[model samples]
Target: MSGGLAHRWDLSAAAAIALQKSLAGQVERADRLGPGGRRAIRHVAGVDVAFEEGGAITRAAVVVLRRADLVTVESAVARRPTRFPYVPGLLSFCEVPAILAALTALSQRPDLLLCDGQGLAHPRRFGLACHLGLLADLPAIGVAKSRLIGAHAEPGPAKGDWAPLMAPGKTGGRMMRIGAVLRSRAGVKPLYISIGHRVSLRTALAFTLRGTTRYRLPEAIRRADKLSKGGAPG
Candidate 1:
C-alpha cells in the first residue's frame, strides 16, 4: 500500500474491480441528495495550489472567509517538493498532501472547503476536491478553471443557468452531482462543480453562487491561487 489509501482509496490495479464495487455505494451516500449536501455558509474557506518548474515544486494556500461579511479570518500555505509525475487523472497525488497540511494549520476553520479543482467528475470519481474532502472529513466542493474530463452544454450568462454534463451510466452524476449548477459567460469560462465530501449538490451550487462576486471563480480559490505561485507555504 502507498499509505495513500487513507480514505481506503483504491489504487491497486488488481483490486480495481473490487474497489469499484465498494465505491459504488459510497459515492452516493448522500441519500436522495447524495454525499455532498450542505447549506451555504458565511464562513467559507478556499484552497489553491501552484506549481513551479513544471509542477515539480508546489505551493498550497488556504484562506478562511466569513460569509456574514466576507472577511478573511485565517490563511495558511504549505510548500513541498512534488514527487508524483504530472498525470492528468492523478493530480490529487501531487496536491492533496500539501492542501491537507495547510488545512491542519488553520487557526479558524471555515464551515466549508472550497477547493480549486474537480471532484466526483473524474474517471475514477476521485479528483482534488474528493481527495481533500474525504481526508478533511468536511464539506468540500471543486471549482476548476479548466476541463479535466467529461462533456457539457453551454450555460447562460445570468449565472445559475447550467446544462447537464453528459456522463455514461454510473458516471453520469459524477460531474454534475444531481442538482449542481454550472454558470457560463461569453468572455469568462464556466466552472465544474461536484460534492466532495459531506455536501449536497443544491448547497454546493448555492455556495458557489454566493462566493462568486464580480469574478468567474469564488474568492477563496482566487486568493489561494495567487498566493500559491511564489508565496511562502505555511
Candidate 2:
C-alpha cells in the first residue's frame, strides 16, 4: 500500500499459485476513485516489462502521462536478474519486483495504472495488474493485447465498441462476466480490458477507451513498451 514490495518474491510456482488464490479475495471489484470518477483522474501511468540477454535480465518500464493530452510526464526503467521461470499464470512473480523498482524511481505516482497484462480476466482472477494494484494500492486496469481466459463475441469493427467477456462461475453453471473485449481501433485486434483493483469493469472500459489514440494500444502503454525495449530514454 505504501508503494513497497510487501511480499516475498522467491516463491515456488506452487506457492505463487496459492498466494494468488489467497490474494484474489482482496481484489475490490467496486469503484473506489470517489465521486469525481474519470474527471478525478489527471495523470495515468502505463507499466510493461521485457526480457534481455536471452531472458536472464528482466527490464521494466513505467511511463506517466497526462490523461487529458497524453503527454509524457515522467518515466522510469529498471532492470533485474530474472529469477522465476516462465510459468503460464504466475508471470507476476517474474515481473513485479522490477516493476516496483521502476515505480520507486518515479517522481510522482499516477492517478491510475494501466498494465499490459491480465487482471480479473485471469485463470485465478488475479494477474499482474491485480498484483501490482494491490501492492501499489492504486486504481489500475489491465489492457492486454491478447486474451488470457474467457470467451466472447467479436467486438464491432469500430473504435469504442466492446463485448462482454464471460467465463464459468463457481456455481449454477452460469457464465460470469470477467472483462471486456474492446476495439480500440477499427479493424484491429481487440484488447482485453479488466479491473485490476479498486475499479469497476465499466470504469476500466471507459478509461481504456479514453486513453487509446491512433494505435491498438493505449498511448501510455505504447510508450512504455517502447521504453522497455530500449527504444528511447525516459
Candidate 3:
C-alpha cells in the first residue's frame, strides 16, 4: 500500500518509463480482471485532497455513496504537513499521502472509488487515482476536470459523445485510448475515465456517468471535491 500496488502488481521505475516513453503497456500488464457482475453498486467512494499554507498542510477527505441511491454512507478525513515538491507529473507523491491517511480512517470499503484526478493518463501512466486504487486494492476510476495529456474535440451538448485521449510520447509511439463525454449541470466537459485498478475504461465511464446529478464531475469526485475542502454535499 505504500506505492501503487493495487493490481497486486508493484510498479517500479524499471516497469514504468519516464514521460519520453509510453506507459500504457505497464498499466495493461497490471490489469487482470474486467468489470465484474452488475450489482446495485452497493458502495461508492470518492477521494479528494486539498492543500493549505501554500501546500504545507494537506487535507484529504473520502466520501462513500450508496448504490441504491447516491446518498452519503461513510466519510473520513485526515491531514498532514506535506513534504513533497509540487512536481507537475509527480503529484501523487504529495497528494497520495494525505489521501492514504484518509483512506486508512475509513470505516467501510467501497465497491467503486472515484477520484478527481487522472488515471493512466500520466507520463508514467500512474496518476493519483491509479496509484490510490492500486494501493487500496479496489475498483476505481480517474475523472479529471482539465486536460492532462490527450488530444480530442469538444463533445456534444446532449451527452455520451466521446473520443480517444492520446498520451503525448514519442519513443513509446501512439498513446491513444478511450475516454468519456459528459454533459453535467455546470456545462459540458470531457471526462477522462481510465482503468485505475479493478475497473475498465468502459465500466469506469458508465459508473461515472451514473454518479452525475448535474455537474461535469462524477458523483464520487463531486462529493470528494467538497468534502476535501470541508464543504457540505451539494
Candidate 4:
C-alpha cells in the first residue's frame, strides 16, 4: 500500500506529541467506505504488534481476511528494533513503524483495517488506528480491549448492546461522544470501538460486529494477535 502520510518516526517525545496534534486535524470522521454500504467492505485487515527479547524487538503482523467469510486471504509479518519508549497516548510512535513495514509487505490491500488499539479515543484524539489509517489512506477502525481516554456507562450484558463513550469537547466545555462501548459477545466485557480514519462510528461498529464470531475479538484481529505472538496462523 502507498504511504499516505509522511513523517520521520525517530523523534523526541515533544516532537512526537506535536506531530500527533498536527495529524489529528487530518483525521476525517465522515464515512468514506464507498457505495453498497457494508457490502463494499470486501477485504478487512487486522493489525497487531508483539514484543520480544524484553521488548527490544517488535514483531508486527497484518492479516487480511475476506469480509464475507472471515477467511484469511493474505498475511505478513515484520520484525524491527524497538525505537521508541512505551509511553501512554504515544503508542503509535512505538508500534507504527514495524506495523507499516508489515503492511507494505502485503500483496493484497484490504478495504478496511481493524487496528488492535485506540483511534479517536486517545488523549490527543489520534491513536494507533488513526495513525495507521491516515498513513495508509484507508478506512480503519480501532478495536480495543480496554479504554484509554474516555468515560462511559456499562453497556448491556447481551451481544449488540452498546453505550456511548464521551470525552470533553474543545468548544463550549461540553462532553463529546468519541466512541462506543460495544459488546461483541453475550455476557462478555465490551470492546471499545472508535473511528480511525475515513469511517463513521456507525460503520465502524457494524464492521466490528460482523467481524466477530465466537470470540470477544474480531476474527481478523484475533488471528493477527496470535500471529504477532509467534503463533501460527489458523
Return the number of clashes found in candidate 2: 0
> Over the stretch 1-234, how does candidate 2's per-residue lDDT look in tens digits?
244537788988889999999999998888877323444888889999999999999999999998889889889999999999778788889998889889889888788889999899998999889999999877889889998889999999989999999999855669999999999989899999999988899989888888887888988899999999998854
Cα lDDT tens digits, model 1, 33-126, are 2223444465788898888777777778898888776677778888878766556867776677778778778875567788887777776676
Better of 1 and 3 by TM-score: 3
lDDT of each: 0.68, 0.88, 0.68, 0.91
Score every model by TM-score: 0.79, 0.94, 0.80, 0.96
Instruction: Give the residue spans of candidate 1 off by over 4 A.
Output: 1-42, 171-181, 184-187, 231-234
TM-score preference between candidates 1 and 4, better one:
4
Order the candidate numbers by lDDT, best to worst: 4, 2, 3, 1
> Model 1 scores what on Cα lDDT?
0.68
TM-score order of candidates, best first? 4, 2, 3, 1
Q: In model 1, how large is the Cα lDDT of residue 11? A: 49
Give model 3's TM-score versus the native structure.
0.80
In model 4, residue pairs whose N, Cα or C atoms come closer than 3 Å (at least 3 residues apart or on different chains), thus clashing, are none
Model 4 off-target regions past 4 Å?
Answer: 34-39
Better of 3 and 4 by TM-score: 4
Best model per TM-score: 4
Inter-residue clash pairs, candidate 2: none
